[model samples]
Target: MTQTLTGSATVDEVMAALAALEDPKARAINESHGDDHGVNLGKLRAVAKQLKTQQELSRELWKTGDTAARLVALLICRPKAFESAELDAMLREARVPKVHDWFVNYVVRKSPHAEELRRGWFADPDPVVASAGWALTSERVTKNPEGLDLPGLLDTIEAEMKDAPDRLQWAMNNCLAQIGITHHELRARAIGIGERLEVLKDYPTPPNCTSPFAPIWITEIVRRQQEA
Candidate 1:
């Protein structure tokens, strides 16, 4: 039986608990995606639930720099508590995909400095960092696109997505899909751009799961929305 984690548990105890939860298959899958954690996400969240919110413990776990520990830290972290510089440092330190992604989706988005960070990271040369920027941009495209340069975003996606690293390419593709799905005025152009680029067109999607091929993705999502 697994032991229950608690907020008062020291970082060492949490580390030991994480080690005990490691699964060989999970490690292999994460390794394939440039992540090195062995804990199943469900179990990791269960551990986090037991720990609840412990800012200082989160800091200690993050300090260890273990992918699993960092994931747990992210789960328990107070998004607004981190200074912009500290968040920037964490983003840089979060080189692995899972850690980088969760940090962006879970913490960075809620920070007071999200827009500033997004603007800076958007143009960063590092694909990994740029991907985070794209993630933030996509959110804005869907929720609040008042000042965004939509045309420019499409222009850059058209010019750069084909040669981008896998993660960055995926992020750009998501932003493209968001634009097409949300903006009726730009829907045709977004679909055109997606069809021409053919990015992820051949991606193998399981049955009933929507394809990431942008044209199909945009169309399918719009269709669902209309039906609802």
Candidate 2:
């Protein structure tokens, strides 16, 4: 469903539009998943589509303390307009994995400070920050690995992956898999570290699907790349 909205919206106007678009089905699913914020308006992308300048809308949406609103804010916000400090504050305020993931993938990844934040956050004591950092690293390697210190990254994963937080470990595992898939020179080392860590070795996978166990994941991805 779409709302008939135009012009710049104040936070209150956006909230009202969100309420008008509320989807009971979506709200139920979000609640079942333990979403902290109440009602969900389902796809607000159309609304965001109408608003050209997202910075002001993003600021206003975030202040409302609603999950859907914040998601819309991520969709609309201009990554370049945000300062590193502002992004840091947003990350700190992000209370759930989904929020953090979107903020990192959508906002941080597009920002000029991506490289700096990825390195800094990977070492942060806060697991969330560290997880985002590793995730950013995975994204970076997938797109470009020109200046990355492959040896150092592998060493870090080998040394600390076993003791890392769940989210961070997942990112580390992904990074290792990415290394094996994208960097032929480092493939063997990445596979070795994955085997040593035994990352997601026995996790369940959908039928006919290879497990995300790093070795298997890396092997399958590499095979596909070669075939293509």
Model 2: per-residue lDDT, tens digit, 1-228?
A: 335655566777777777777767776777776564445434577766766557887988887768778877888889999888888888888866667778898899899988888878878898878888889888878888889888899998999998887888988888988888888899999998888889799888999897989889999988887899
Question: How high is the lDDT of residue 131 in model 2?
Answer: 87
Provide C-alpha RMSD values for all models, in order.
1.1, 2.4
Residue-level lDDT for 201 in candidate 2: 92
- Evaluate residue 109 in candidate 2 and report its C-alpha lDDT on the 0 to 100 scale: 89
Clashes per candidate (backbone, < 3 Å): 0, 0
- How accurate locally, in lDDT, is each candidate? 0.94, 0.81
TM-score of 1: 0.97
Q: Write candidate 1's Cα lDDT for 1-228 as tens digits.
A: 167777689998999999999999999988988889888989999999999998889999999989999999999989999999999999989998889989999999999999999999998998889999999999999999999999999999999998899999999999999999999998998999999999999999999999999999999999999999
Give the runs in model 2 whose Cα sits over 4 Å from its true position.
21-25, 31-34, 37-42, 208-210
Q: After superposition, how far is residue 61 of candidate 1 from its true place, in Å?
A: 0.6
